[model samples]
Target chain A: MLNELRKIQKKHGYVSEDSIKKLSKKTGIPVSIIYGVTTFYAKLHTKPTGKYIIEICDSPSCYLNGSLDIIKYLERKLDIKSGQTTQDKKFSLFIDSCIGCCDEAPAMLINGKPYTKLTKEKIDKILKKCKS
Target chain B: MQILRKTDQKAYAKAKKLGPKGVVKILKDKGLTGRGGASFPTGLKWEMVLKEKEKEKYIICNADEGEPGTFKDKFILVNNPELVIEGILIAAYTIKATRAYIYLRGEYEYLENKIRNVIKKVKAKTKSKANIELIVGQGAYICGDETAIIASIEGKRGQPRKKPPFPTVHGLYGKPTIINNLETFANVPLAILFDDWDSKLTLFSLSGDVTKPGVYELPVGTNLRKLVELGKPKHKVKAVYFGCFGGCMPYSNINLTNENVCGKDCMLGAHTIIVVDEKHSIVDMATNVAKFYEFESCGKCTPCREGTMRILNILENISLLEARKRDLETLQELAEVVKETSLCGLGQTATQHLLNALKFFRKEFEEKCR
Candidate 1:
């Protein structure tokens, strides 16, 4: 039922307890089990997030190619830490393990679209597009 | 070195002329194997799935290349998606599968539309009965494992199930399923179409401390020294890590061949070759890899869930200079236990990086401890 939760979250921003209860009633799966699954996956969020989710890959390959610099740049540009959403709910930044784009190191997903071989200038452009 | 450059149009025509059984015979003759870590014979897998009496057999193409240092699948998907589709269609026709799903990684969300369009085009052109759907993963590395992938497709937490009922027998909502990796499926068209198909040519993802790090199509037995030459090391190479967190070998020990790389104890998983130069610290590398496992463990069972965390803790302590000499012995013992006791391949091979590090880079661990 993780996919169901994902759909609900996609529609409603987060899988609220009320939606979980409704899903439980609909699928006959217990609310507790549904909640456990939501907490298990990193992609599923209990709280509301920003309009755009920026997930930066911090795995070894990305790290070797300076993924940390991208993370720092995002943190500074957004004025928030990795797990936090901006006050305006414009963006939510996170450090993901690996996004399977190691061929293009220093890669990340800007609202699920990949931006690879990141640079300070490229980050500025991406952030500008998000802000606009 | 240029390996697989152009699609063999002649072979494609030949395979199409030969029908399903004839193509199967050619695959059996070629002895093509799965490109996804396991390296099981592709022909044998197709034959087994074909023999299943179940009517609702499904074909799953694993595009969830989550293993770190592995991007060969992504390359194949981007460059020649049609080839992969042909492979999937060939598999479905051979197995009489009416439904198929490409379990793509969420990071590869951009490729979804393109692949869907290709599937639509192929469906229109071939008029195949199999309905293809793309299932995007939710950023879980464990889902790359076949059983866990099936669980994910079932809308459940991506945890592995017991193996008595393998996917070939019982899979994907309790029906027979044949799940092949993107690379494995991509090779199907080549195997079917070309009379001169060489199964030895495989995609390798090369990265880390190399000047020309990228995906390359090379022979199975290509030597590490030659591959290193292709990449052109930025510094003197100290060691090479094969597969993604699977195994580590000193530069001197690498043969770069599939057989030598994947022997009894070791697995040349995903053909991910990570070169570590002399300036880098093996302890730090091992610690990072252990931390990755600790984070990604599905927590279905105790051995993997708890053991990975303990291994990470021990490695971190050693890196921080808080570990005693006996801590090394404890770490080795723990790795052996985890390797033997874990349920799935992820847990079973999790400690391989650490164990191999301990074996080849003992002095690095000793220096950190001191």
Candidate 2:
């Protein structure tokens, strides 16, 4: 495990990839599987996340609910594309398929939290908060 | 408890002073997310609502915790009404909403009165621009969907529709409406105030394997294995299931902490962990969840309505078959069919457990066949 942790420290600059792999390996999971743990799920991260991880649910539920517009609005405001970190290192905008709150479709996840039934105004408000 | 009965005034005060952006910061720092099934970042959700188009929109709090074996919302209503109120204020302000509604579950009869008292208390004090209303649901789980929920609010049938223009565009009497889950709304204030939802050990309605089954608060990222080992007393845990019957998962797949199996639904889904101890059969868990889907599936979609029933019957009959690779292929095929054609997300994701169980625990399913 220690060896794997050191390997992760050497592999990635943020959120140890090796530790996750070691954990997965210990749990009978593959390294790629561990990546799925982070990649597939928005909450789990493979890298040391930026200050803010702006997540808009792009799942069928959220997308069909208007997350695409929300994403566009965010991209325009942040001047960064989805799955990319902001220049200021303050915000990391990305798309999450689902955070499980479909009842509040058109949802988002900033960091690990979820916001449902989104709008441009609400997105701006959240970005403004992240700016603070 | 009396405090729970009153409107969540403290949340408003915090939002008032915190401002929209500041609230987001606090929420981000506190790691707070909406507790209503989908564990999206509450601060971010508020941010989205705040940064959006300038239209008279609506905010609805979803208190219809009807997924079976889930009741953490009751505690939020009992212990943190003010928090919920504060979340609403922030959400309303962010979304530029003129009004906010708390669509509480009808089964929670006490929630209605308690919420009403809180609204009255807030009304007595300084009122915000947004009007707050406390409404009751007919205890229909389908009503939990945003579209169905909107229809219900408009005095229509509670059935979800095909999304496209989405709710942010057309919702609630043709106006943009944002509906959040009960726990999601409760997390709003905190997310607006704190960045991490794991500031404390949130409550979980754990039952099955161990001893204690009532609602208990466990530290975020706490290993479920440890909880199983020490939650109540070490019992024979055959398999652990996360989420409820609606979202229940099989054991082996149950690992806790950041490991995925550890926490049931810390942020995104139902927090009910049903432990099918060694004594019970995984087939039984599958049966219960399958039965749940069969019953709860909104008939709007044929694949879900029929596929779910078919999956249940197949699994039940698999025990009678020779338990060959063909049965496995059949199970996988049924799962795929259900996954492809479900109208709502619940029906679609319902097969995650069954698929995983059949794939990993093939021996167990085969054992049942004998």
Candidate 3:
């Protein structure tokens, strides 16, 4: 059920109520249960997010490797705080618990593709690619 | 340097020749155990699943290695996925399971394509009867628990069901199921091929403040200091955080064997080590680890959900110098409650690292507290 919602979010940017209702009807699960599942998972977004979602790893290993610095850099560069989508709806940034990339710490996933060993210049280049 | 090569079709054939009971016997003789940190006897688990009379038994390879700092499974998938597929086949054949699923983690989106290709190749080569499928998780750490993983596969919320009807009897859509960790399954083929199973080595995901921080295959019951030495520390190591938030032990207690790391005070849950040098702050590390549990809690029960959040709050207070001395006592007491009352291993062991930090590095917390 969670995977189905994630697929829907992947295609549509967020899980709309109509999709949820349709999913509930198709799967024979209650709408409340669907909502509950969606809300319980961190990756599943209810409302529409931006074109690109930036998930920064903020767990201990990543934190020790200066993931916070990358988050702060992204915030300053993108002019939006963590958990906020851009005013132009181009990017939404948030801190993820851990992406299982501790070896390559200071990692973030831009639209589910990992960017590891991050630097300010690398972040600039990544955002530039997204812009284009 | 390469531990796993091609599918080991010869080993697979030999294992298949040995009937299910014979295979189980070999597994028992080999002393193979679950690499997912529980150290449950693999042979015993397979024997139990094989004995189940259910017609629709299932086998699941738990590739959801989301435990922080553990990526040995990813290494296996990337480099030697065929070995894991073969392991799954052996288990399926032994248990007569008609279906199997590899529950891959969501963070490992990159490895999906490679694993899918390997699965295709292995299926074509072996012509196995079991219908194998890959189920991708949507970012939740609790789903790593076997029951929760089963629930997730059933298209429900990834929360654990209370154990009495364990997965061996009622699992994966209410049929008998067998789930093994990725590394555990990877070891199956090796156990079949090699006779010296007693000396078989296991992979350790080593990282953090080490010169060569990566996966190392070491003998079972290897010492902590020996494993750390493999990584080549960058500085004077003050402590080692063994087994994926398992627990923290000071440098003085470095002489630990794999079998004994989970003593009365700590656990070596997943065999993942994160070295903490002298420069790192213990308070900050504990706070970050607590924050992880708080965020990842499935909220199925109050003790885990509330306890983790409360622990995180107190840790944050301590870090900011706002916590009173009494908060330390409350933190310890809260950890005990969560460990005792939580529904799943996530809650039961969530406070382990925090508790270890408090036990060994109380002065760090004390310095921060008023």
Candidate 4:
């Protein structure tokens, strides 16, 4: 069921109500059940996200190592808060749990790829490349 | 690291030669425990499942390494996929399982293809009956719990279930199942091949307040000081947080083991050694941990959902210097209640670090309160 939801997400960038209804029709599963699974997970998106999704580690290890600074920098640079997407729909920023990169500390993921040991300059370079 | 790096099928070959009973004996003799923080004796766990009457047994490799500061399982999977595959095969063959699943985390989505390739290669190379499948998690940390992982795979909300009929007897669609941490499975081959592999060495995830932070392979009884020193601290170390399962321990010459750390009311869980330098505040660290639980709580049980939010509220007030004197007592009472009444490990250990901080560093928290 999750894999099917992921397939729809990959194609549509988000799981729409229509998509959920269609999936429920095809799978013979209840729409409420499908919605429950979709919303239960942290990764699944109910609303449309930008082209690129940005997630910074907000757990203890990263917080101790200056992830807050990196988060502030991204918010300022993207002109959006933690859960908001940019006006251009180019990026969406979120403060998520640890992504298993504690050794590198202060890490973020862009479109499912990890960017470790982040600094303001490093984030600048990453976002600049994302824009291009 | 050396033990985890070897990809030889010597252990599998040895297991095949010795057969099921002989293999369990070898694991028992090695004194190997589960590396996934539960510390259950691996041999005994396998023996229980093997003795079950159910014919349709299943094996699960718990690759969902979601603990905040722990990544050794990811290290094992990325560095030596073959070892993990061989370990899974060993478990399947031992218990006569017809199928197996590797629940990899979605955050580590990039590793899916790499792992799938390795699985394909391993199955092709071995004439095994167990059909192995890799399922990526949908970003729920509670799924790291064995029961929760099963629920998620069954297309549910990934909430942990009550455990009396443990996974060994009843799990994964109600048949007898054996779910082992990816690291625990990785250790299976080593235990079969080497006589003393369990006590010789293990991987430690070292990070925070250090110049050189990475996974370090050290001896079983290695002291916390040695592990912290390997990270090369830039400032004097004040305390060490063990994965968040184990609370913060003041910097001392304590061995990084359940026996050693347990004496100090801390657990050496998953060997996640996070060094806290002198510059950081205990209240701030505790608040950060509280916030993590608040975001990750599944809200299934009232205590966990409400308790985590309440703990965060109190910790936030403490951090902001607005906490009343009575708040400390209330926080202590709440921690004990949540620890006792909560449904699963997430809520049970949620307040552990906060309690630990209060225990060892009460002065810091009191100064913030009236």
Candidate 5:
């Protein structure tokens, strides 16, 4: 069911009520239960997000190594806060737990691709690359 | 370094010759333990599943390495996947499990293809009977727990359930199951094939305020100072946290072995060493960790959910200089209750860092208090 939901979210940018209903009808799992499962997980969402989701690690190792500074820079550059999507829906930002790249510190995953050892300039280049 | 000192498929071939009981004896003689923080005896755990009368059994390789400071599992998976796969095959054969799953964390979605390729190759090369599959996690830290991982696999909310009808007796789909960390399984072939391999060698993920931050495979009883030096601290190391679950210890003479650290009133949980310099405030670190637990708590138990929330609030207040004199005592009392009353390890160890901070660095918290 999670794999199916992920597939739907991959296509639609997020799991919608219609998708949940369709999944329920197909799998015989009640819509309410599927909705509950959707909200229970951090990856699954009920709302639409931007094209690229930026999940930055703020766990102890990353935070101590200045992940907050990276987060602040990304927030300023995108003109949005953590957990917010941009007006054009090009990007969404979130505070992730540990993506297990603590060795690099100041790390994040942009659309599931890891961007490690981040600096403001690196973030700029990444954003520019995303835009291009 | 080979994670298990050897990663050849010869171990699987050897295990086939020795059979289940013989392989269990090798693991027992080596005294291998789980590497995913719990340190439960690996041989005993396997033996439990072996003793079960149920014929249908399942094996799960827990790759949900979500603990705040731990990344060694990722290193092992990426660097020594063949060993992990061979270990998995050996385990499946030992317990007579026909199905096996690798519950890889979702953040590692990039490695999915790499792991799948390795699985296909290893299974084909071994001509194994177990049907191995990889199931990626959907972002829940609690799913790292055994029961919770089972629940998530069953397509339910990833919440932990009561144990003692343990996973060994009654597990996935009401059948006997054996779930072990990927690293724990990686050690199995070492126990089976290598006669002189030391079971004490363990991986430590060292990060935070260090010049060289990465994973190091060292003996279990390696000194804390030596482990930190491997990372090359830039400033006077003030404290070290053992993967956020073991609580923190002020810079003092300590060792990294489970028993040695446990004797010093800290846990070497998952063997993750986060070296903190004197420049950082303990209050800030505690609040940061508190917030992590609050966010990750599954909300099944009130003590854990509410306790972590309130613990975070208290730590944040302390960090912001808005805490009262009694708030310090309140924090300790709250931590004690949360530690004693919580159902799962998440809640039980939630306030460990703060409690340790208050014990070793009370002055820092008091200075911040109004």
Candidate 6:
């Protein structure tokens, strides 16, 4: 099962359906259970997950700090909504709850690194360099 | 996925062994209180979990520290994951449980990943004889409560239930379970590493009116006066809004000091302290906090569901042109009910901030209510 997971990893990318299913088998938790869990939870995904799943905080503070317009700029640049997959399949946008970095409001995740106090121009610059 | 020793806190030592018995001893020595908003006795909580007679026991570290003005758990979990990890290990050992789980907030995906990575590293380096699972809660405030946390971890939506057959007796898979806050667990590593001497390490995040608005680690007896003095740039700190959710104190406490302050002395939360700066409107701050509880109320029980919405209505009235002196009295009455007679701790304790803010700054509340 481990070998099959490795082969699947080699064939696909970082995350795979078989690997998630294998985790289900190893844990004695049903395959569908794992599938449901992966899908139900916003963080987990069955398919290959991007290295950077940028989640822009759309909470009130971020909204006050102009996160919606920032999201629009991101959508135009990446050509996708907040939770949709991109064409390049490199970046995926996650509509996040309050990131709690309200002091540095208008925060977003870049490769799991939280970047706060963002502007449209700054976001564009970050996107140019952000991989996934 | 390696352990990050990069903590701003004064965390230097590592506890090689702090099994259940050692924890009891430390609890006795430090007179350590629970860090989960409630300053209840840690020893008593331990006794509750230990008294339970169940073969399949569980230990859960509550990393869902989601109080709006609080980020103490995030700091510890992100910068110093081992502190909580060591604590979780000790809890599991004490409860005689082979399975330990850390339940974090869904919105805190970044922090959750931080913990998950550390768990992986810990598993790889040390042979985890006990099976510890890292679980993320799907965005619910009530999950901060032990019962809801248990439900969420068991692959179910997080919601509160009756608690006479408390979590210690029947939790997670109909087994005895122990759940504690992140700061509580972080303290465990200190209990293990340090001599059983009484000392407290604090992480106070100074925001709003203060000069520095970051998490600061200090010692036990530091006065709030000195702490505020340190936070000042040039202007005097007019007020303070320390702790989160459940407990709140005066603005003068933050103004009073620049030295270290411990748990039992002041109104700081389990591991967080916030100072409201001069420029930010305290009225606006209080109203925003009131609205936060109103928005996050899980609507499980009557006292919380309707009460919080009514509070929101009053707050919106204050924001608009309909607030009255009677509204303040009604808000206070509702706060008492929500604090005392709610289904879970969220509603029961959610009113603490609003009440504290209003009580401390009644003039501000009165003025806002117009």
User: Candidate 1 overall Cα lDDT vs. reference?
Assistant: 0.82
Ranking by TM-score: 5, 4, 3, 1, 6, 2
Please report how far candidate 4 places residue A21 from its true position, in Å. Answer: 1.6
lDDT of 5 by residue, A18-88 (tens): 99999999999999999999999898878889999999999899999998899899999999999889999
- Docking level for model 5: high
Sorted by DockQ (best first), the order is 5, 4, 3, 1, 6, 2
Please name the candidate that would achieve the greatest DockQ relative to the true structure: 5
Give me the runs in candidate 2 sitting further than 4 Å from their true place. Answer: A1-132, B1-8, B162-166, B191-201, B244-268, B318-328
Can you tell me which runs of candidate 1 are displaced by over 4 Å?
A: A1-4, A25-29, A76-79, B1-19, B262-265
> Per-residue lDDT tens digits of candidate 6, residues B176-195?
77778887777765654555
iRMS, candidate 4, in Å: value is 0.9
Candidate 2 vs candidate 6, lDDT winner? 6
Highest-scoring model, TM-score: 5
Worst 10 residues of 1 chain A by lDDT: A1-10
lDDT of model 3 at position B307: 97
User: What's the DockQ of model 2?
Assistant: 0.01
Error of 5 at B141 (Å): 0.8
Residue ranges of candidate 4 with Cα displaced over 4 Å? B195-198
Please give the CA lDDT of all the candidate structures.
Answer: 0.82, 0.61, 0.84, 0.87, 0.89, 0.64
Mark the regions of model 6 whose C-alpha exceeds 4 Å error after superposition. A1-97, A102-113, A119-132, B1-23, B111-114, B196-198, B233-236, B247-250, B253-267, B322-326, B365-370
lDDT score at residue A78, model 4, on the 0-100 scale: 93
DockQ of 4: 0.83
Winner of 3 and 5 under DockQ? 5
Off by over 4 Å in 5: B4-6
Better of 5 and 6 by TM-score: 5
Tell me each candidate's TM-score: 0.92, 0.64, 0.96, 0.97, 0.98, 0.72
lDDT by residue (tens digit), candidate 2, B318-337: 65664555666777788878
Clash count for candidate 5 is 0
In the predicted model 3, the residue pairs found to clash are A1-B155
lDDT tens digits, residue span B1-370, model 4: 5655574677888899989988888888887788888788888999999999998999888999998888888888788888899889999999999799999998898899999898887766666667898888878889999999999888888999998889999999998898998988888888788754645578899888898988898987898888888889999999888877678878998777678888888887788888899999988999888888988899999898999999999999987889898999999999889888899999989888888888998988999998
